[model samples]
Target: MPRRSRTLTGLLLFTSLTLTTAGIAGIAATANASPEAPAAAAGAHTAHKAAYSMPGMPGMPASTRASGDDPDGDGYIMADPPVTGVTPSMEVPPPAYFHEFQAKCAPTHTAPDDPIVYPGQPGKSHDHTFMGNTTTNANTTTASLETGDTTCLAPGDKSGYWMPSLFDGDTKILPEGVQTIYYKSGVTDYRSVRPFPKGLRYVVGSPMQTQEEFKNLKGTVEGWECGDSFKNYNFPATCPDRQDVQLNLRLQAPSCWDGIHLDTPDHKSHMAYPVAGGANYNSCPADHPVALPMIEFKMAWPVNGDMSNVRLASGTGYSFHYDFMNGWDAATLDAMATHCIKGGLQCDPHGYDENHPGQGAVLDENYELP
Candidate 1:
């Protein structure tokens, strides 16, 4: 993902956080799904999101953030702005926390279904490798997601995350090790980063896209990884034969969202990437003004060495796409944004920043529900 642009001087505030349980009681939850494909692991916040607004949006009933900035006049403000030159590294940089938090997960199952696109109809889509919400399928619903078993470290992360299944020759392969999914502040200001609404669903990338089109996507970080080197948009012809290191795919979701609709016919109309200002992204487009956590997926594939035949079920390596359905424990997710993001710190899968080990926002004892 492109770094926040300094071109749009001053600071921009993200508003519009009015999460309510209005749909089917069972399928009702936070409708927060970004266009980026984050390998989500943090327990998803439950469905009871308070009817409150973030910094730049109206109706800010209460705010834990101290009063400091009001770029768009939403009562909320930014006390301490983001550090100017701190570039995010693919790997977490020790104890220093950035404006980010993460969840780690492993594959739970595979199916030829997509609840968001072809709901209630299994086998309507291509085979997909799923993580989190173990029971995710074509019939998956918000209620089902909340109750399904999870592979993520955070118990609250009931959300379902998946990508087209990958294959080596004719045999299917799965990702090995823990997959880290990052939810970060997409806006330059982190104080107002709000949690996504429940049941929110969105698609990132498309199997039908051409290689050039995939390359033009703002959030595309297309590539494979083998130890120290990682620069191939398509799988490298080969990789070092090793166990410690596996092939990886890191993807990002668009951070900006439209406050109104949770989803649209296209599944992507409600979300958008930050617009370019100079060389970096400076602000969200007017249509998608709400700046939510930028979802980043660092998927770890099991294949190594022989990369002569590795491809996604969707098509060529460039035909990458993924899906997300918000099903987090509402309270937990909200706190994560409060302490880790608004507090401006990089956090672990449980939203804990060891460097500032004070009792701030963090995962509860079991990292899950009772």
Candidate 2:
């Protein structure tokens, strides 16, 4: 696709309003001097009723009741009552465990030719910032990826992940210390979670105008924030004076899979995000019972100034999306998922369990990225 320019005023305005409202609510709750607060009392009542609700995923029923009665007896009823389930355990892999990986920043002229976009047409897609497998391109296939050299710390890993390029005016900015961290937590039962099946491919985020939608609206884990503090997704952060405008783009892949299809026609129908707010928050759907390690991509770019001039080949900075092609050895990937992720142990790039030293796979200290 050809490069395009976009405006961010609407997104910024919506974000600002949301933050302001949240801040006001916090202040109001704090300023209320009455120990017998009505809001708190109401919340306690709702929480008690929510305990008995059935478990369900988004767009699915949590209970047999067509709808539940409004706790306050108001005419409008709330969303399906929250369901009950285990929450996924999450942690950040340490920097010491960073894999010895490297890839040159790909120019717009070198967009990959993969199933996610321009599947059979080379040069039909926009430029992307690629990593992991070095030979990813339009002609890459499952078989080709299996035999590809990987940039992962683990020699057995051949997965490839990439996102749109970040540009400041006419200059392309590259991410620094491009580290990939793995997490094993999900809302589903740990026993049901599994490693990514080989050859599975999918894309997260969108290249369309809807890309500007916030995480809650999109129902996906994606956002833009400052590199220094990547957690603040409420708004796009600004850099302090004299410092480069370093921004972080985060896209978290779906952890729930259907267990049957390695890929669907749309490349996404078989996968779903863990529910966000029910008793089953972050849990997988019944149809997609296999819980997999959640893969999150955080790309930090140096914009160097105001974002007004920032644009991506897809559209605007907010139009960010990413692709993932799983090429892991099935046995090794499964073991890592079962022993490290599901085991609730933080592992290094080589799959070494940091919690229990000497356990899990060890990296070749002498090995370097090709």
Candidate 3:
């Protein structure tokens, strides 16, 4: 199996716009916003939803073999194996859904662990800051943006960005004497707007295009969203082309938050998995089990040759990064939290009960590059 690569930490500062009608100009105007605009002041606005995306990994079929020397040695041993004779599990999930979200200056959401390293440059390092505090303008414009220029942009923390673990706590834990973890495969297709969504940013100093390759091949495809019924919601008598090829190979566990417990109304609760169940090989360790979790996705539009920086166009170059955080449900979270407590790592849950910390464990820690 080929190893995944890490992403660049920082880029040279650049000026960009916020999304507002009149108070602030659109991203287009920001591309031309005069410095005389009195340097827009920061407002009291916080990130509402997590911005993240999975990046490309070696295709699942190819990734199945752990190494060459031991080519056939338990090569198919996975907690959840891939579906037989279907689209490769590594391809993007089918019917990828797109959501409109706010775009913010990158610096405001930096992770503490993010080290400042200028993009495409080496040896020189510096802190990054955002162009503004909130998207006060309604027209949605970004102005006078230039990469590698210090006068335009800013910095933010990049710590605790990716999902700590699929289990929600420290260490990879599996049941004793388990025969195999079961998983099903399905796909989801996703599309974007003309200029792509704005106000989208990542605290990890990472780019969004990196995750596209991953998103395209590993999107989750199950439950109501994937032609299944949770309510009286009548789905297609037969799956449509819109619902072609994309699929998620997940553990055949019951419905619960974050892919446990088979009962639930939401499909987004399902996270994309690389190695799922029901195979006759060994892709992962038998005694020690582990899986990746869903995280925030960050993406960026591409700037053309003559167009001003802020008016840049969106393309496959539009990178995406997933920030796997603590959003799993109580049961799975508590189990991992228990594991972490035993290991001496202090954790505190972000959105649940006071006693239960939504701590995540680390599994395959690396950037998802296409």
The local distance difference test score of model 1 is 0.63
Per-residue alpha-carbon lDDT of model 3 for 83-143, expressed as tens digits?
A: 1232222223223122111112222211111111111122111111122233211111112
**TM-score list, all predictions:** 0.71, 0.63, 0.23
- Cα lDDT tens digits, model 2, 1-370, are 1111113322332332232112111111012123443333334323322322223311110112111121222111211221225334332323222221121222112242333443434444555656667667765666777887765556566677777655555454555533554555554345546667666776665554243253443334446665454444333435443455466665666766655445432345456666553554446655455677777665666554455666654555555667787877766676666656655566665556555775645344522221
Sort the predicted structures by lDDT, highest score first.
Answer: 1, 2, 3
For model 3 the TM-score comes to 0.23
RMSD of 3: 21.4
Worst 10 residues of 3 by lDDT: 13-22
Candidate 1: tens digits of C-alpha lDDT, residues 1-370:
2222323211222221211100112221112223322222111101001212224432222222211112232222121222133222222223323789888877777666777655655665666788888889977777788888788888878899999878776566777645789998766556656788766777776665566656666667755567776757677788888878778878788877666445543456556776543343255656566677889888877677878877776657776778898888888788777878878887887677877778453776676532
Score residue 282 of candidate 2 by CA lDDT: 46
Write the candidate numbers in order of decreasing TM-score: 1, 2, 3
Candidate with the greatest lDDT versus the true structure: 1
Question: Between prediction 1 and prediction 2, which has the larger lDDT?
Answer: 1
